[model samples]
Target: MAHLFKVDRVRLLCSCGVLKPITAIYFCRHCLKLRCGNCVSHEVDTLFCPNCLENMPSTEARLKKNRCANCFDCPSCCHTLSTRATSIQAPSPEDSNKTVARKVYYLACTSCRWTSRDVGLKDQTVATGGWSEQDNEHYKYLQSLLEHYRSVAQQEKLDRERKRFSHRKSAYLSLTDKYSLPSLLGRKSLTPLSPYAPKGDSSQSLDMTASEATAEVEGLPDEIFTEEVVLSSVTDMEQRMASPEWQPEKTSDLYPLHKHILVKRSLRCRHCEHNLSKPEYNPSSIKFKIQLGAFYHVPEVRMIRQVELKSEVETCVQVSLCNPTPHDMTLAFLPFVPEAYTAMQQKVEEPTDGGSLNTSSMVRVVDIPPEKTDLTPSADVALPQGQVILAARDDTAEYDDQDSISSYKDDPLVVAWRRANKVGINLLVTPKANVSRAKVGFVLRYDYTNTVATASESRTVTLNIPVMVDVGTVSE
Candidate 1:
């Protein structure tokens, strides 16, 4: 009996405009055509490892050169190595000896003369269509560990919250006692004056009687004022205590009445064991001042600015080290101007510096040692108008070579051009190894003088550069 497969659709058209079925036909993605394998031109496909064939997805297969993605060849010689599996056999009772069984595949690359012995095979299973046995015990253990950690974290969070609430409540009570008690006591007198007080004459009569009794007690002196008199004197004290003026010192005055008070404390870093602050107090004023000494090195370079009419032009650029450091630091400038360094060096060597330079003549080099004094400038350099100039040197001076004219190099015209065009000059502030922190000030100034009769303008533009320091490494 013969089995037949039906073509669901005709995907290609013949030259005669007749549609053709695509079943058992090869498809050409480039030509957008379908043809039987017999009618189409055939190419040999690459052979791949069987293990790779069972794994890697179709998208990954294309990226991995259509070969087995899981397999790798020897770097010394192109060779596919085999993975071996070994199993120990059980010992028989009569012989009291055991044997072993091993399985391995020999892998070799046809194009390369390389070979290796069978090493080992990874333990993996080729599953038939069925559900795997559930590992309930392992899952339960993981769940228990997760619950334990979560519960511990939640308890710690609750403890922190409780502490915060208690601190807030205590602060609230203290503030209320300080600001509210005086007003509450002052309002107590207003209640008795409220049209109540026994309607005028009765309250007046009670006050007159109290005054006469106080006068009579004052008149009786010495012998009559004995222990019984003292006891009687203390008995009426409770009546006087309720009066606002007779109460103990008001809570409002508990805090110091003075606006400014000196506070003294010592502070230290727990990690580095460094004294961040010392016991220093200013008695005249309540302010505390902290002094930190930071050392910074400013390494800058100056370059001649030249604007060219043509797309390709060479401009002379110079880098110098201004060693602000107490000790000498190494510096160098590397030009990334394509091929401009040769021209810069040639211009430096030439005796005459006669051309009017523009901003385009300046090129910035980045990430070079600040100590390097010698630099060979480029020849013909190509630059786009809006291109960025990133220049760096080992140090912070525009001119380091003693042979060069220092006075002329410090000219505002040169300095302004370099500042406006150079990239790495003020890119970042970097602290030296021994320094704690640095206060860096960067100033870019330019003087423009217009000799034209119609108009004249001169101004300076400044920019602050960020500083970055490299800290020492720490091990995990």
Candidate 2:
């Protein structure tokens, strides 16, 4: 049981030639292929704070620099800062002789026992916001620089568009040629207009003050090695670097940091351009609108127990196959051929019926090829000859003591045990003479019932998935 949690004894080969667990791979229903993280497209859906769970729009998030306004983090420990209320004595306005107790709120970190008062921050009357933020001295200059760069990029984009349209005639010229009108009439009718052309001269004259290099650099303040230092008052590297704009040297200078906003991302299949996983829009909901994890669509293979092996000797290994889908599955073990698998994957890359989005013209600029994996088996596996039928997943099967009836007959030598939707099988493995560990690879051919099938497509389709198992080390 411990080994099952720690080791990936059984791994499925993804279409990108990388071996991953079934949990990490995704099945694209439209393409009928496996997609790994490296081969999928990620899109940010929403930005929200983890502490307050307040959703923020993309524009607002950008304006706020992707941080929550009300929520704050401790500068010392990088933990969520909680508001602590304390009672303080205040003079009553109605009566000058008496005093009243007023509750004041201050930000405190429970993890590091740091408080806003430690940094000379005044306590606020209200619990929520009102935390003073440090102003950046170079903010105006930075904004000017950003605007200059944006205009430059816009100008370059217009130049490229102009170059692309250089071969084609203008709208005025086209109209004149089509109507056989005089050139004077064409010029008087309308000027040649371009959609990509800049509307004003502001973009053309965009500029910023250039920074000049100085010969002298600012030096650190001198203490003359006379003042004693307290280690507790000094800030560590992590605390000082948390706020890049103002790197505080001492704990007294540390200020409450705005909590960084987190984003919920949706994954799409790179080949088919269909969503593989999409979470709900609400920040509080943990449910996903669409999830196509391989664990739900493909058969999962788990090693029942660790098996002992000897070099160049045959050993038996037991493994369990669980059908995760609601439909019954017919599974068979086939000898894995790396060449055949690669060829089959190439054929699977042909575009299939996808969503309404046209992905044919869409080009990927940042598509990174997955690293090549060694599919050669270190050991030989003698697979079972016949097919094994697995029952549909029943949620209540675990509570029932009586076993369900099976229609299809299973070979006793191949199948060791069967319960619910899981079936245990045994296979013979022979490690190489010089190998220290035994590794066996095979192809699991299963009939998958596609739930998202159209009228023209078949509901049941046969898919062959390459599986590799680590059969443990060979005994000396």
Candidate 3:
């Protein structure tokens, strides 16, 4: 039986030759093909903090190393840290005889009950961002190494540009005619010298020393073997690894970590380079600007009940089909042919100039081939003959009491029942001799109404989609 948790029972074949459920795939209007997560391109559209809902620009995010400046996470539990304030009595600076109460803020994790005060971190005078950052002992050495590499890279780039410029013909050839050879030589001497040319004393120097490997190592302290260990005061591997710059072994060294930023991305079809899903620009909004999920554009198939299957025995299995579109649909079942789908993919037309220019104009370094999946069915399915008509979707049909089944004449053996924009049909399945789990597949040919009409094309088109259904295990 089809349940919300059992969506994998019925799967649809994606254009990349992978089998996926209808809810996990997308329908591209320009390419007229089914695309899955593996066959689509993802692009980050926005960067924002999930806690404060504050958006940051790309340059600012890169400068901050993709971390939220105003928010923090608990180092022990990795949860969002909340700011808590407390009041304490202190001697007044102007009047030593009087005592005054002042409020201070500290970070706390409600989940793990971890607070900044556990590690002896000083309370912040203000709530936003006054906490001190951890300093690395090798910071100066790392900066020197980075500067040395940057200078080397710059020198190589200059050499490459100088070589390229030397190969090109000089544009000042005509100027030599107006001036004598001596004057032309004098003009060349006034030009600046190439930076790549060697200069003995005037050359810039980088301050960096090469590192050498050594066999000398520091031994563990004698307290490790002489003193007893307390597990509660030690930090786990996960907590220590959270701060890689300074992996804290003891719970007293742990500090609050900066909250990482999250990104909102949009999906695009790889073949035609069209946007399949796009979210709104607002940071707090959950709605989408353009979403083309298969659930909204394709007919949904659901199994009615589980059935037992024996070898050479025809068992009736009921399945319901629901049309999600506003226009009426005419659908028919056809025999599934693996070879036909392969040939059809080869004949798929290339994208033409109809919309905006595609962004994938750069040459690719590696070209990936489409994946191929095995689709052999283990059971035989006796598809009902003729076509089935599903009415357009109506919002008020659920309130109506009158039966909508009497309007259409249907075969009682094939059509089990009829409802608004949905109909149930019976299928006959025969399992193979040694098959434990029965599986059947078929091609669904339906007339689709294209809402994106062009000047030279019609609004209706025919589409064929292959579907595979996993029936229950065969009965002995």
Task: Identify the leading candidate in terms of lDDT.
Answer: 2
Q: Is candidate 1 or candidate 2 better by TM-score?
A: 2
- Give the RMSD in angstroms, all C-alphas superposed, for model 2: 8.2
List clashing residue pairs in candidate 3.
none
Name model 1 segments beyond 4 Å from true: 1-146, 166-420, 423-463, 466-476
Q: By lDDT, rank the candidates, best first.
A: 2, 3, 1
Local lDDT at 97 for model 3:
94
lDDT of 3 by residue, 148-169 (tens): 6655644444454355457653
**lDDT tens readout by residue for model 2, 1-476:** 58855437789998877789888999999989888876776777889999999999866887798899999999999999999999999898899789999999999999989999998999999999988789987778777766666556544444433543575533111111221222332222222433444554484446666789999998756873767888998999999999988899888899999999998878888676889999999999999999999999998899988777999888889999999999999999999987765653444342232223423222222445555566778899999998899888989999997886766588888999999999999999999888888889999999999999498999999998999998888886
| C-alpha lDDT of residue 175 in model 2 | 17
- TM-scores across all candidates? 0.18, 0.82, 0.79
CA lDDT scores, all candidates in order: 0.27, 0.80, 0.77
Cα RMSD to native, each candidate? 39.4, 8.2, 9.7
Q: Please provide, for model 1 over 1-476, each residue's C-alpha lDDT reduced to its tens digit, 9 standing for 90 to 100.
A: 01112222112221112223333332221222222322221211222244333433333443443444335443223243333333435455466675444333333334433333212222322221111222344566555555554444433433433454545432111111111122332323533443333333332122221114344444656666563544322313333343323332322111101011112433322222223233334323334342111112132322222112211222223222232223322222222331232232232111122112112111111112223212211122221222222232334344544333322223342232333123322122233233332212122121211122333323221221111111112111
Displacement of the residue 391 alpha carbon in candidate 1, Å: 14
Cα error of candidate 3 at position 169, Å: 25
Clashing pairs in 2: none
